[model samples]
Target chain A: MTRFLLQRIGLMIPTIFFVSVIVFSLQQLLPGDPALTMAGDEASPALIAEIRAKYHLDDPLLVRYGKWVAGIAQGDLGISLRTQQTVVQLLTQKIPVTLELATLAMIIALTFGISMGILAAISRGGPMDYVARCIALFGISMPAFWLGILFILLFAVKWRILPASGYVPLTENPLENLRSMIMPATVLGLAVSGVIMRHTRSAMLQVLSNDYVRTARAKGLSETTVIFVHALRNAALPVITLGALEFGQLLSGTVLTETVFSMPGFGKLVVDAVFNRDYAVVQGAVLCTAVVFLLLNLFADLAYAAVNPRLRGR
Target chain B: MSPYVLDCIHPFARGPLPAKTGKTLLFAQQAGRIEPRTASGKATAWQSEGPPQFLLDVRDLRVTSSGGYPLVDGVSFTLNRGETLGIVGESGCGKSLTSLALMGLLPPGMSVSGQVEFEGADLLKLAPATVRDLRGDRLAMIFQDPMTSLNPTLTVGYQIAEGLIRHRGCDRREARDRSIELLRKVKLPAAERRFDEYPHQLSGGMRQRVMIAMALICQPALLIADEPTTALDVTVQAQILDLLAELKDDLGSAMIFISHDLGVVAENVDRVAVLYAGRLVEEGPTRSLFEQPQHPYTIGLMGSIPRIDTTSEWLPAIAGTLPLASDPPPGCRFEPRCPFAGDKCREESPDLAEVSAGHRAACWKAPL
Candidate 1:
């Protein structure tokens, strides 16, 4: 396991490096010069040139990329053009919100998705199965932003049970923070839970049909043990893989959901940075998103090895 | 002694006269061809007697799909205590389904009916919970492919001990010791060291041993082995078969050994039932069935087993595939494939009736 971790982490360096290059190049491709955007619409050419010089916009692409990467190497992500705050500082403030939201959403998704999936599979073609499938269908069909809005209207406007749109750090007040996060996290989780449900249901169905499951039944295991203990462990493999990827996507910050909930997360930060031509912040956010995806992939692999011992020896 | 053994001897020695069935006359050489008035009368007679002689008595056990199409049509047999009964059939002949039905493990949408009387209770009529309690406690099964039959995620020892834990209510430590002992009984090498290994770590034979250990952990009264050795190497197959025989003897468990291989069945079982399509075409003492196969399908099956004693370069093959359950022949399920199938064979399904005292054949041309 230690060797596996080390190997996985070693592989991440090149991946993150490639990702940084891609994000930097892609940011350069966006329309409108950063200097001109920063100088404002009616600014004179001289003012724009001065802004460009100040930001080292005249440097060769490679030299600018080198400078950016060097700053990152020293834990400096450069300063956001819009706010004049370091990209690192901005991320530190926003990462916690998205991380908490994603983790909570993942917990909710896994619980409902796996339990409902197991239920749906065991009682296949029954009323409960249909209900679970219909709920999944609804989840997959409804947009997160739209669902967030609907949840806000119902839970906040209509019921006055939750805050409509706001942010509260957990350290500031855990209960209040959870209250504010509930709608957004649930809205974010629904679609993924639907994906997880479909995957888990199908995986469970296949695993339940396996020969070992029959052996388990023949062993006189109760219906629960047969389905959950014998079957679910194997079924969980694919679900975990998909879940980790979904969680990584969650960590990247769901733009529409954050906007609907007025939660200042990575998605909002990156969107604002992009719109304002804050090259440094965009680069940092994209690089961090890449790292999050890579880390999740690693975790998924480790989880796979853990659940299926057949993979461990190798 | 098996009642059938005593039953067959008495009738054969009497040398009864030929029996008429429609126009055809069955041979008198085998003896005892009188038909019973009704099947229920026989059951009543057995019940009126002191205690049931058979360990497991199946009467007209039928399995049908949700659409009411038959998968395993009316099949009946009796297993004596500690006796091994082999169910022989080609692929798609419901050999596995018959065993699954007995275990109450048939897949959803497949309905099983009729009687499976085990230990004085009709398994079919028993509540699911009752059947479940009986399953791993007094009844167990070893499946066809050990490679897949053992859960890959679990340790071999843990899997073996699972039945003990569930049925015997053994604590983990007790279950573990018993499982290791069983592993040794199955002749698995390094039983102690191998206990914690997963299914994939074991070879085909080793995995099968683990499966056997699992089935034997509870020392079930009846063990259903469905093509247990079919997935092993030829040498490994023999070892596993020998292991099963030894274990069955040790436990005195009645076994229903389902196999398509007549060779394996002949060597391992005392009596054999030959299933053709969804029907039991022939059944008798293994020795008699192999020596004198009464049904055409059974004859075909025996003829198809490649023989070292034969001079022929190419073995005779049973022609055509098994008919689909959805569109079975109107008469005998094997009519389309049977070389001896006549007008009666095509127009009417034959009931499994007495040939000799203990031997029964479903074909009208029995004793051919």
Candidate 2:
């Protein structure tokens, strides 16, 4: 098992390298002069030249890429052109807010989504199943940004219950943080919940019909025991895989959702960096996203093995 | 038992019918509804002939889909203590559904009618909670395709111990000890180590042994084994059958062995009930059913099977597939497939008539 985990980690190296190359190339291809953008439109040509030289903008692409890769190896994300702060530090400040939102979103998604899915499958063809199906359809159909706007209108403007835009750190004030996090998290998580609920329902339906479940019932297990214990353990495999994918999406940041709420999350950081032509922050964020995504998949594989012992020994 | 209570009646209603068209035979529905179990159920006391000898007595048990099409139509049989009754049939002959219906494990919304009287209580009318309590502890079942019957995710030990813990009220330690003992009883090698292994880890035969261990662990009064060896190879099939026979005799538990294989039923079971197109066609002692089989469908089944002891140039198979349950012929269900099907057979179904002291066949030309 340890060897298998090691092998998976080793496999991610090439994928991360490729992702870094793509992020770097895409930054280089963006139609703008970064040095000029850093110096401002009104700056003299000589000042742009000075900024370019200082930042090694005149170096060969290979040399610049080599430098970038070496810096990545040492945990350096390069310096932000405007703030002169390291990209790593800037990301660290914003990532927590994003992480908090995503975590809450994931919690809500899994708890409600998986339970709804279970209920729908167990009560199949009943009114509860129909209601759950409609909810899933609604969740899937509504766009995140549109849903965010609707939430803002209802909870903030109409109900006078919440702050519609901007975020507060949980450490600053737990109550305000929760109030701020609820809307965007709902907007970001609802669609994923729908996806999870649908997958969970189908997976559970398949598992529930398995002969083992019948055997469990034959063993005189309560219907609850048969469904939740014998059935859920097997059904959980697909749900875990879906969860990993949703986690990757959340960690990468829901850009449109972050933008609407002015959440000052990693998503907002990346979007603002794109507009300002801050290649360092964009590249750093993309690399971070790749690493986290791969790691999460590895975590999912481990979780799958944990849930299913057949995979563990193998 | 009293010759016949023959009556021509409509299926939807009771009492005598016009007898104008066909539809003469009616396997009378057992009259009585076991009221819902209440705290005062003991006061009812089941109004019995003092604890009937049969461990399981099924009378006219029928399972129908929501569309009112009977999947298992008017099936009746009795299982006495320590007697092994094999229900032999081809696929879709309502063999498995009969067993499932007995366990009250039929899928939701499907309709099941008829009395399943076990231990003085009408099982069909018993509350679900009561049935659940009875299952595993008193009435157990082992299904076909051992490969699929066992839970893939659970360990063999846990699967075996689940029944012991649930029904037998054993603690974890006792459950584990008994599980190992059961694994040993089923003749699994390294029973202690194999107990911790999952279904995939074991061979097909070994997995079936695990299934047997699970079913027998509770020492159930009745065990319905539905083609328990169908998924195994020939050699493994023999081994499993031997293990099952040995375990059953030693445990003294009644068995309802449902199978499609004639050889299996003839070899292991004492009595055989042959089902054709969801209806009981013939039932008798294993020797007579195999040797002097009365129903043409039964004769066809016996003839079609290849025998190693006596080689033949061609096995005479029953021509035409079994009829669909959705639109059954008003006459005999097996008439279309029977070589001796006549105009009388086409217009009217036959009653389960006594051929001898202990043999019965549902055909016009019985004891031929």
Candidate 3:
């Protein structure tokens, strides 16, 4: 298992390298120059050229990419043209807020999705099963941005219960941070809950039909133990896969959610820097997203192997 | 007058069957002995045999699906202490359902009727909660496909000890000790090492041994083995069969051994009940049933067995598959497949009738 995990991680290096090249190409293709955008269109041509040299925008694409990779190797992500702040500095400030929202959303998603799935499986073909399916349908149908706006209107504007949008540092006041994030977190959570629910229900139903479940019942184990102990353990393999995928989605960025909420998260930072042609920030953010995505997948694989002993032992 | 009644449906002790149990003379003899052995073994030894102690008595057991048609109709049999009865039939002949009904383990949505009398308590009459209490305690079952029957993730020891802890109220330490003893009883080598091993770690034969240990841990009075050795090879089959017989002898538990293989059933059981399409068409002592099978289905089954003495290129198989039980015809359940089917056979079903001193067959024409 350790060997498999190491191999997976080793393969990630080349993958990230390729992805970084693609990110650089996309940044190059975006309309408008970073130096011009930073210095303004009316600035003298000489000043623009100096700004270009300052940000290494004057260099050829290959030389610039090489220097960028070297700086990345030395843990320097360079400065954003839009903000004039180091890419790493911007990330360090915004990461805690994004992580908090994503983690909260993931927790909500797992709780609601897993419980609904178990209920649906246990009460298969009954009303509860249909209800869970309908919930999945409704959740997946609505766009996260639209859902976030709807929540804002209903809970924030009309109810006067929550702030409409924007983020607060959790350390200053944990309560307000939580209250502010609830709407966006819920919108994001509801988006992925459908996938989790569907997977859990199908996996659980399949596991419930296994011969060992019958054996457990024949042993006079109550229905609760038979389902939770015998069936759920086997069902956990797929749930882990779905969970990891969803968690990776959460971490890489919830773009629409942060935009609607006006939150300064990694997702919003990436979007703002992209439009402004802030090469360094976009490059740094993409790298972070790729590394986190790969790590989440690796974590999922390890969890899966742990649950299914046959995989680990073999 | 003969001491035994001639026409009674006793599946064991082939002779003039006693008219009824509790005659004063037989009762006095049992009272004289401080302890008695297995009913069949003791009955074989003493000239004066008392009323046999019944371990399980199922009467007119009928299982119907939610659609209200009978899946298993009018199946009845009695098991005596330490006696072995083999229920033999092709797949989907209600053989497994009969055993499941006895244990109250029928799949949901299938309705079952008729009395399941075990230890003088009518099991069907008992509430489901009571039946649950009896399961893995007084009545236990081990299914075919030991590969799939055990929980894969749990240790063999945990599966065996589950019943001991739940029903017997043994603590973790005591249950562990009892589990090891059970493994040893099933003749699993290195019981201590095997106790902690998971199902995948063991071979097919060893996993089966673990299943047996799980079933027998509670020392149930009646054990239903549904083709326990069908998945095993010849050598492993014989080993498992021998282990089962030894366990039955030592534990004094009545066994209903269900199998499709005639050889496994013939060697292991004292009596045989042949089912076709949810009906017991013929039943008698194993010897007579094999030699002079009166019902055409039973006769056909006997002919299908491959014999070493006969050099026939093909062993005759009972032609055609079992008819679907969804809508049974209004005659003998086996009439569609029976080559000996007469007009009467197609017109009416036959109830069990005495063909000899003890053998009973459900057929229109007997002693064929």
Query: Which one is best on DockQ?
Result: 1
Question: Between which residue pairs do clashes occur in model 3?
Answer: B5-B17
* Position B334, candidate 3: lDDT: 84
Q: What would you estimate as the lDDT of candidate 3?
A: 0.82
TM-score of each: 0.90, 0.90, 0.90
Q: Rank by lDDT, descending?
A: 1, 2, 3
Candidate 3 chain B weakest lDDT stretch, 10 residues: B6-15
CAPRI-style docking class of model 3 based on DockQ: acceptable
Query: What overall lDDT goes with each candidate model?
Result: 0.84, 0.82, 0.82
**Model 2: which residue pairs collide?**
none
Off by over 4 Å in 1: A42-46, B1-52, B335-348
Among all windows of 10 consecutive residues in model 2 chain A, the one with the lowest summed lDDT is A250-259
Task: For residues B1-368, write the lDDT of model 2, one tens digit per residue.
Answer: 11111111112112122331122122122211111111112221122347647778899999998788889989888877877888988888989999999999998778899999987799888888989999998889988877887888888899999998898789999999989988888899999999888898999889889989999998988899988876775556666876887788798898899988665565567678998887898988665566678999888876665433455566567788877778899898888877787898999999898897567999987778
* Model 1 CA lDDT for position B124: 98
- Give candidate 2's error at residue B123 in angstroms: 0.9
Per-residue lDDT of A151-233 in model 3, one digit per residue for the tens?
99999899989999888888899899889988899999987888899999999999888888888888888788888878888
Per-candidate clash tally: 0, 0, 1
